[model samples]
Target: MGVPRAFPHLKMRQRPVNISNFKGSTIALDVMGYVVKGHYRMMKTSGLADDNTLPDSTPGVISSVEDIVRTIVAAGCVVYLVADGKKLPKKAKEHAARAKKRENDLVMAESCFQLGLKKEAKKYLARSTVISPATVDSLKGIAAKFPGKCFYFGALFEADSQLGYLAQNNLCDLVISHDSDMLLFGCPKVLFTMNTKGWGFYYEAVDIPTALGWKKYSYEKFLKMMILAKCDYVKNIAGIGIARAQKIIESSPDLSITSILKTVTTLFPDSGIPDDYATEFDEAYFTYLYSAIVDPMKMESTRISPPPLDLTEEYLSFAGYVHSREQTLDIVLGNIYLDSGRPSRNVTDPSNLDELFPPECFFNSMYEHKKEVLEFDVDGWEGPSPNEDDDEDDERPKKFDCVECDKTFDCLSRLLYQTVTHTNLKAFSCHLCKRTFGYRQTLELHMRIHGGVRKSKCDICGLTFTRQDILTNHMAAHNEARPFQCDQCPKTFKTNSCLHQHKEVHLQVRRYQCENCDLSFKRIRELESHKSTVHYKARPFKCDKCEKDFTRKDYLEQHCLAIHTSERPFVCEICNKTFNDSAGLRKHAAVHSEAKPFRCDICPNMTYKRSDHLTRHMKDTHPAKLEEFMAKKKKAKRPPATSTEEPKKKKPLESTSKANIKIHKLSPQLAKLVGQSMMSQIDIVNKINDIVEEKQLYDPNNHLYAFGDQDLVNVLGVLRFKIANVFNLLNRHLE
Candidate 1:
């Protein structure tokens, strides 16, 4: 509602002026704004009651208000407390909408409280702030108590408009309010956030032009910019944000609604400017510029009265009558006049009657009594009765008993955890899987997998998810708004979990260790997959046609397309020849480019289309070079060899560096099938080529491998490295 991004740009132009600079000046105070602000500040400092309701008048609120008022008077400024009256007829629609939203928020807050989500409940509760009759009565009581303070309750308009009218008519030199709308209301000067220390921000109307770098800046121009940037009155252009709207406004000399629209459309053609934008803009511009403000001449005259000497008693009496507690009254009075030579009371005594009466005590006594009765006779039925040793309650820790297991614990959290794990207290069960869950939300999430019920759908990609939270996370990918940033690097992520996972890379904490082998992974999921594929030899994904098994689903799909089906999805652009996959097409396209990217470091002239080809060139042409490469590779592969290690513990020469051996012109089918085996692509390729050469899959007459039958193909498809064991296993199967 305030000018969008207005303060960030204007901060450089802001001049720090103290309250002493405004001595002898008259100021119109937005009394309700200060009251609301004070109430929230009090609620924050003083913890909320057990029932989560804010205390009507806290010591903090009274002290803060008194301090502000005292500071203004000491500055020699005549202060008028301006309160909002009835809503304007034109604003009634907005008022009703706001009330409806507040009601919804209150309902959600209550729901969250019932669900034990205290933090979320507090957030919703904060959004439901409203000025009730009690608030008005309290403000009136304050005004009545402090007679010297001039108080004005407007009859037909908001306090902001009335304050602006008074300032414009020279009745007040400055308007003091937290509401930024005071500036838009044509108030000449305004002071904001005045604390007890006589410190606050001073915003002058004359500085607007210089701050915005627009010499011709007027109230009308400012209102138009607010409309374009989106105020309560107008819906902004779909893709036009505050910065873009400012640019549009600054580029045009004439700040008419039509001219602004035309300029925006011309400059940003992709802004998705609506067809009825002009109509909406005109309405918002008119409402802000003309309809919103009250005429200064029509407003009533403002006057300041002298304060009564007996104001302290009036405030003390009012507090006692309203709160019905003498202790609260004492605290309020002490805070109100603490700096005015008045003796203050100690409000921190835990044994005080007011402090002892927690909000939960009023409503939860019956429930507590029932629980106490149940605790006494766990195996038998009993009626509720008062505990005789209630005076000694503070001496011992409260006990919690798990009803299902008949187990008792000193804390409710321990009992609840035990109940979930060791008892049949899980009421929510999945229909399909017959699995029980301790919570209803958990059961609902599990049901999504079996029922295939996905209600939340993304608008852009039409992808659906079982949960709304999941769908919200998915939408972040489309917008590319990574709000969770890494402290170690420039990389940002859409979710906190992603950021947490990325942080482990910097820590290098490989916590998930494989039990069968010494290999470890950073994530538990990766380690589990490794164990299933390598150690357990589980091929869960099966090709439908040939019944060939694969460790991964992607591998099974690739096998079906490359071997079983004649589908060629990727086509070569130069020759128009087609292949089964992109890798095959890339190999074919390399012929058209006439470039050999893979080259041997030892021999500069030796290059090939495939890495395996370059490897064979290095091995066959230079045996000594191959041996040197193998020795270095073997040393790199082995863990740091201990000096005192036994000869038996040392790696056998033949068992090491077998993956380093190379083969030339390997078939595309073998490349993809081996790629899907959950093994390193480079190592697996070399190992497969070794097996093929040992088994004689490659023909002497042709450069390509010739598969004689389906059995031979199947043997190659299921090939994995087991040192010298791989060739013997393939020979036995093929023979």
Candidate 2:
């Protein structure tokens, strides 16, 4: 059995006397969200210019262990950074080079691979501890990396796990992060947990309430109320938060979460959470923030429904933005998959499809569309204010530029470059949310999103959403035509979100990231959704057979099947096995090279592509690879290769500007491509003919078309005989 928790919620459990046992220790921050927020705040606070900053400077401070270490040293603490060292040497080199890294990226990521028994890890074990995610099958993986080798590290975490050990054993002083909910997990202390910036940044422990005088409750009560609010959020309630929950509790000082839980259990069936409810909460929180949240309004809102989305028509009626919410989601998913052609969305097939996309619901594709991706601008105001139309009437002039970027723009947006500038304003405000913004135009936009107003309405059904694309999609249900079909399942939606959400039914995964620090989540939207709704956020590494994203790129490529892809075009002189991905092929061939031959730059890594990828791999994965390789070899030289890989063209997305926005919004180019690639035009026409013919038999009164075109009807006398003759021929062929 596992060790039990202190049940921190139980009253009279005075701060454990040994709490200081966690003091003065070091913690690793994901540094992604914070980094981005920091940069945004800096740019907003100080209008920057080219000479003052670097281009792509938004991934705020603390990109590397080196940076963290510097901060730690300044604070007078002994610290060590936990890293996926297998890829370190490569990644450091990439940071040195300003190569193709993303503009808003926190730091370059280097893929960690399982290599044979590592000698360095064993040596490091004697001095410092190291940890990896808890999901790696190290016994099998280690054996493969070093058939006869053994390794020892001071400490080692698994491939995708962090908690069972970290929790039972106190590893540090406090967990610090933007999300303060970690206190519920029995974390000792947390700081820099507020949403404010810079000078406003402050630290708080579990006992913050006592520190700041509360009328009826203590600090623990304060923590409990906030945690309750987070727990309630996991259930889809929109207006619940720390303040609201606090106010509720303060109004009834005698009420505690224990009582609330009891009432909920008695009243709300299934509130008797299953044993692993904690894990569920963590997954939900992580997904809500990292993957996709269920919002009919926001950019990362959960997906649902058919198209010409029900919300699209309504939004276009008033909202001026030409793109609809569903379209935005399509673009985001397109970016992630890097598919130039939009994959056909078949959302009409799911049984519970209505759970997400109700007629009046809205949502967006979040994983890909960040503020940086959209490049939106914010306006600034000074004194009483000066109108944009009356710019000449202003006494003070505004100025700014991005230091690291190539171009400069006004501080009006705080962003460097953008395709559109904000001019029309809205005065939309939500009484429930109590948040106000710049323009009437902005207010109108917000109102549409928050249900204050409806911007999109389906022409076919009059269903609405804050976004227009959804309404257009809703109209597709009345289309009388369903074209897109899934290769894996019978499930389909009129739109992609509906279809994909149904697909989640077959997936099996539970990836966990400690919200206590900074880290990146490819599925942040889902994480946020989970956090906003779940109770105790437990840690679990997910292994879904099919996933929109994975903890590691290679995990799902070959189904994580024991036998990897044999994209082995490069046959080993020693073996004749084939391979699929070039990287796998190279990994298999590594045994044959005697010259320590597969050096990527200065790092001890393998290579698949020629110089560009190799150089990139060195710079991004192993900073030490290139220099070490040069020093070990005495000179940088290449092995003679008689054969090489053919240059492959990266398929870029073709803009669907003139795409048919009719009832069925299928792109003409995609339709043609699908006809040519998946099936022939003749095949499509034949399939349609078969459906038409089948329908004709059921409804004898309907006009029959001999040709495929709906407009070309068969003249009864001549076509009747022709249909019989063609079908007769078809029967003979079938026979």
Best by lDDT: 1
Question: What is each predicted model's overall lDDT from 0 to 1?
Answer: 0.55, 0.33
Residue 451, model 1: Cα distance from true site in angstroms:
31
Per-residue alpha-carbon lDDT of model 2 for 430-525, expressed as tens digits? 443334454334544555544435545666667766555556667777876656656678755676666666664443332333242222122434
TM-score of 2: 0.26
Clashing pairs in 1: 148-307
**On residues 252-333, what C-alpha lDDT tens digit does candidate 1 reach at each position?**
7688777887898788874656546686666544443333223222222221121245534333221111122332233222
lDDT of 2 at 116: 18
TM-scores of all predicted structures = 0.41, 0.26
Report the error of model 2 at residue 278, Å.
15
